[model samples]
Target: MAGKSGRRSENRFIRYLILFTWALFCLMPILWFLSIGLRPRIEIITPQPIYWPSFSLDAWKMIWQDWPMAKYLFNSVAAIFGSVLIDLVLAIPAAYALSRFTFRGRDDIAFYILSTRMMAPAIVAIPIFFLFRNLGLLDTIYALMLVYAAINLSIVTWIIRSYMLDIPKELEDAARTDGAGDLRILWEIIIPAVLPGIITAAVIAMIFAINEFLFTLLIASTPNAYTMSVALANFTGGSDGVIYNAIALVSFIAMVPVFIVVLAIQKHLSRGLTMGAVKG
Candidate 1:
């Protein structure tokens, strides 16, 4: 028993060590970005690696004052909320129906929906551009919101469906016996139980929407529609040379909302990712 306990302790220590190492590896880029973002431009561009940098706020000031950062932030936040709302509203019903009911061509329909994700976005980018252009939605926040929602719809549905499938059918049967309708059951029982999964799906949708650059680049021509992701490009070009510090600031700005969201819902998110991983 003593030897077994020792082995278990050693294994647990090694597992935590690996996890810590991996987490640090993933966080290195963000740390480096912070390091570069807080420093003077001279230190950022210097060939030699400096152990420490003199903190400077010139880049922060330039972005907040000189650039229309508020507009970019508004556009980004609005688009994320809109797209995620649309994704949830649309995906929830599809996931519930697919998870709880069976009908002709149901499998085919689910497959078709999932297969949309397999289609490369680049192939449809031009067509989508022309479609938005024809609809006069180009250079509008609505265009980005719609595009982001569309891109994430299938995955969101599938993710929610997986979680729903994990729910015991007996629960629904019991509810039905007590005069519960589909909508009532979904709202009262299933949704509450699967809240974590839904949050996870929303997080996923927000992540894609926030980080999307290609569609925004093609559809949103101006700053009013383009978000923080594209705003980084403005720092990389023109005769003044690359604004490395500005780029770092933009990267940090883009990451903050997502980071905050993930941190706030980390408990649910951890459960959502693991407990929601069963078959659909």
Candidate 2:
């Protein structure tokens, strides 16, 4: 018994160590970005990466001052929110239905939705471009929003449905017994029970929407509607078609919102991710 206990303890320690190492590896690039962003532009582009900061915000200031940073930021905000809103409005009820009831062709319907994600955005970009052009949405924030929503809808629905399934049907049934209707049950009971999951899905969807580049590139024709991901690409162009320091600075700016959200809600994300890994 003593030996078994010792082995278990050793295994736990080893597992923790492995996890810690993996986390550090994942975070290394982010830390490097921070370090680079803070350093002098000259120091950042040196043959060797500077371990210490020269302690300057010049690159960041220059990026904000020289570029339409505000416009890019606004575009990103608009795109992320619009996409998330569309996804949630459509996905919540769909997820609830899929989770709470059985109906004809249910698995087929779910599979159809999931299968949309398998299509590459690049493959469909030209058609979307033409479609948006005909709708008079070309070079507009709305076009970016629509494309992002369409692409992200499948993921949001799939994720939310899994979380919905983890919620006990008995709870909703009890609400129904007490005179609650479907809408009431969803609004008051089911939604609250799965709020964490909803938040997790929203955050993930928002992150993906914010970071999306290809669709943004194809759809947005003007700087007014261009997202940071697109704007960042502009930094690497010229006869000298690559400003290494500016790239670092722009990249850093782009990652801040995503990093903060992920760090803040990481626990919820972990829980939501595990929601449907097992049957109740």
- Maximum-lDDT candidate: 1
Best prediction by TM-score = 1
Give the Å error, residue 171, model 2: 1.7
lDDT (10s digit) by residue, model 1, range 246-277: 89888988988889899999999998888965
- Alpha carbon lDDT of each predicted model: 0.92, 0.84
Model 1 misses residue 74 by how many Å?
A: 1.5
Give the alpha carbon lDDT tens digit for every residue of 1-280 in model 2.
9999999999999999999999999999877777777767678557875555578877778788888898898888888888899989999999999888899999899989999999877889889989998999988999888888898888898888888888887898899899999999999998887877788889878888877989899888789789999998887886746766677777877777777777888888787666667655
Candidate 2 TM-score, C-alpha based? 0.85
Residue range with the least summed lDDT across 10 consecutive positions in model 2: 44-53
